[model samples]
Target: MDFFNFLAFYLYVYKFFLPKIGRVLLFREKRIGISQQGESTLEEEKSQIRHGVETLVTEALHISKGVLGDNLTQTSQWCEKKKEEIQKRNWKAINGSYISSIGERALSGRLAFLPLFPALPPQILWSTVSSKLKTLNNTSS
Candidate 1:
């Protein structure tokens, strides 16, 4: 019975709920194209993108909290903390590169799979440490 419940939950999340959320998050048009904009204008555009990404993440995390449990909520909090650290840096210097890199990494890295496969407990632990190391390496260099 518990196994069936888990299976149903997994199927629902993977087949229906997550795909809808992904469409909202990944398909949004946040780019304004390559134009001859000044630094301040470019920075404003990047900030809007960052805020959109953050909102998407928050909504996804809320869904995960309802479906998965505290583990995902904790993981999301950790990611947000790392993001805050990056944001606290010189925005003029970082120039939205960090947010873009974070988005790329999230899509390519294990974080993308964690919510889809809650049965793989060890992967969550491994991915968390691996993600932290990658963030540190990226920030240091």
Candidate 2:
């Protein structure tokens, strides 16, 4: 199959079968004092996911820069300026609440939302870059 189909299958196995299997194995090992290793394994998985997402974002940004040419630099500068504005806003309480909600949902095995989380940043970046490129093209023409 193609890449996206393969990805869907992989995520299916990861989101559904893997967790169930891990729980079952951990339960069986619980009597033997081996259950503590599961926490480390989960942490490792999270780290890998974080790394994969970062790599995806980097690749997407590279592609965008190649496509947008000079406009991307201007767009990135604007994004950086907006980032400072965003950082000044008080989002601590909302951010904490959102994090806890996702955490609770993830722990409960409702991974339906998991696939969308990693895509959001790249999608937002693409839209922003594309919009800026369009505006730049219009102005130049």
Q: Using TM-score as the measure, which candidate wins?
A: 2
Error of 1 at 139 (Å): 68
Q: What TM-score would every model get versus the actual structure?
A: 0.23, 0.28
- Which window of ten consecutive residues has the lowest lDDT sum in model 1? 28-37
CA lDDT for candidate 1: 0.75
The per-model lDDT (C-alpha) reads: 0.75, 0.73
Question: Which residue pairs clash within candidate 2?
Answer: none
lDDT per residue (tens digit) for residues 1-141 in model 2: 699999999999999999999999888878456546767788999999999999999999999888898787889999998887685465645665665565555444533554666766866755765675566445433
Prediction 1 TM-score vs. true: 0.23
Indicate which candidate wins on lDDT.
1
